[model samples]
Target: MRTAYSVETVRAAERALMARLPEGALMQRAAAGLAAACADLLGRVYGSRVVLLVGSGDNGGDALYAGARLARRGAGVTAVLLAPGRAHASGLDALRRAGGRVTGADDAEGPIARADLVMDGIVGIGGKGGLRPDAERLAGLADRSRAAVVAVDLPSGVEADTGEVRGAAVRADLTVTFGTYKPGLLVDPAREYAGIVRLVDIGLELPGEAELEALQHADVAQLLPSPAAESDKYRRGVVGIAAGSARYPGAAVLAVSGALRGGAGAVRYVGPAGDAVIARFPETLVSDAGPAGAGRVQAWVVGPGAGDDAATVAEVLAADVPVLLDADGLRLAERDAVRGRTAPTLMTPHAGEAAALLGVRREEVEGARLAAARELAAAYRATVLLKGSTTLVADDGGGAVRVNATGTPWLATAGSGDVLSGLAGSLLAAGLAARDAGSAAAHLHGLAGRFAADGAPAGAHDVAALIPEAWRDVYH
Candidate 1:
């Protein structure tokens, strides 16, 4: 698992570590890492033109010290001070001693344009709500420059805790973050601004609970269900899918297709699209008696293309088993019913559906995804899996929100979300907790999408068919 800490938690950890270390030792460690990364990017430090955008904060000190390192290695380094008077005194002296020159922000453009690399140390994790006008101009200049822009810690003007970019932010080709990841580096909106991220361990010990956690392949492999010798179809767990309608039968087929490959021993589907589902997947245990008579299932997946069947949604919600609500079920299910359920409920919504539930605009939800997912989870007393470029799974109790970015733009094709819904639901049936189920399913779904697409467009069924491929990749 890749973990991220909030600014507050990180600061506390940093302060504790700094107290135990010698004066200036931590900063030197950071600077050494930053300088090394810059050297790697430049391929050769000698004769390279490097521009550092320095502010008054410690980030500026990191940049200055790093520039000094480059300067000593025969690079032509220039520090452009946005706040000259407040720049780190010792760092400034070090840079000058190493033969690096100093320049004001106004004189930075020409050097920045000619540079091989531009280091952005304008703002650190504590800075929020975007860049100031002067800083924005410098960020713009860096964007236009031929130099490969590298941001220190994080890209300037993005919210480190919430992953929100309210105004003008630096767009870096790479970001060198220290100690651990920040939520902004992992979540989207701000994640889009941070092109690529590299973590440098400054040796700050964090608490057990992180602000956000991203599951890698090995982590996911542990969560997958494997049958024992005594296991049968019933013993392995059955997933009940109540989806589709007369108008949209494909949703049922797609959802059932995903469930079949989702490690469930069997899938019991109940809906108007029984014929369509049976034709596509004859292995499915079809039922016409709705969720109540879908036989016994370990979990239920309600609503992908279910249309206006509030009755079915309510019936499924009343069941004493884990439930995954998606598509039309997200729309039709009563809020109070979902909130009052004793069993675990996983609500998967894209931005638009999430916005509808929150009574906000779609853009609002998209812009502040971390906040929106937590809010929705709290509101419904259920786990929320907000689907987008970065899929986040936040539990109602709230510890660390899980973030997954294994998907491609190709996963946006029709019925893709329906496939994801079934996959996640199957995991729920296999007894993973709501958060685990959502996170692991998203990881697999995304990998399957990538395998299916392989750099071209693919349909939802193609994605579903590739789940076994994704599962095998993770398991091995």
Candidate 2:
């Protein structure tokens, strides 16, 4: 699993490490790594023109030292000091000795436009909100430049603790982060600003529990279910999908399609669209009975295109097994009912749906996805899988919120979320915890979406159809 720490935790680790290391040794290590990464990006650094946006913090020191390394190797490096008097004194001296030129922000535009590379050290994790006007102007200049922009630690002006980008921020082609991954680098809004992230190990020992975690292939593979020789269909587990209405029968078909491939022994579908589901997957155990009368299922997925089926959603919520609430269910299901459930409940909501549940603006939820996810999870005392550009799974008793980035932008099509609900519900039936089920399902769902949409538009069914392919790729 890929883990990310909060800025406060990372700062503590950095301070501890600095105390043990020789004076300036830790910074030197960081600068060396930064220099190497820059060299790799430039290919041949000797004749390149590099522009550094130096601010008042250690981030500026890192850029200056790295610039000095490039200058000594014959590159024409220029440092545009945003805070001239407050800049790292030793770092400035090193750059000057190594033949780097110094300029103020007033002269930065010309060099930025002509430079082969621009390094942004304008603000570090300590800085909050957005860039000051001067730094924002330099960021705009770098953005307009043809040069490859490299951000030191993180893209300046984004919240490191949360993935919120409040105002003007630097957009880097590559971000060379020190010590550990910040939550901002892994989550969205801010993630889009950090194009490609490269971690440079500055050796700061951190806590075991991170603020966020993204499951890698190996971690996901370990969580995937495998059948034993003695195991039968019922023994493995069955997932019930109570979804669809007369108007939107395809929602039922799509949800069942995903459930069948979701490691569940079988799918027991009980809804108005039973006929539509049977036509697509005859293997599904379709029933006319409501969720209450449906044969035993280990878990249930409720409310995808369910229209106004509040009774079915309520019935599923009362089940003893784990339940996944989505789509129309998110609207029809009462907060008290969901919270009163003895079994685990997982709520999957897009920004709009989540905004409705929280009684906030959709834009508010979208802007602060991490906070929204956590708040929703805590509100219902359930696990919440907030779907978006970066899907996050957060549990009521939070530790590390899981983030999934394997999805394509093409996955934004209709019914995509319904497929996710079924997949996650199946995992819940297969005996994974609410958090694990949500995380693993998101991982698989995203990969499937990628395979289905290989640079082309793909329907929700196309994504569901490729789940096996995604599973195989992750397994092997």
lDDT of 1 by residue, 80-126 (tens): 99999999999999999999999999998899989999999999999
- Name the best candidate (by lDDT): 1
Per-model TM-score versus the true fold = 0.99, 0.99
Residue-wise C-alpha lDDT for candidate 2, range 90-156, written one tens digit per residue? 9999999999999999999999999999999989998789899999999999999899999999999
- Model 1 spans with C-alpha error above 4 angstroms: none
Report lDDT (Cα) of residue 24, candidate 2: 91
> In candidate 2, where is summed lDDT lowest over 10 consecutive residues?
285-294
TM-score of 1: 0.99
> Total clashing residue pairs per candidate?
0, 0
Would you list the C-alpha lDDT of every candidate in the order shown?
0.95, 0.94
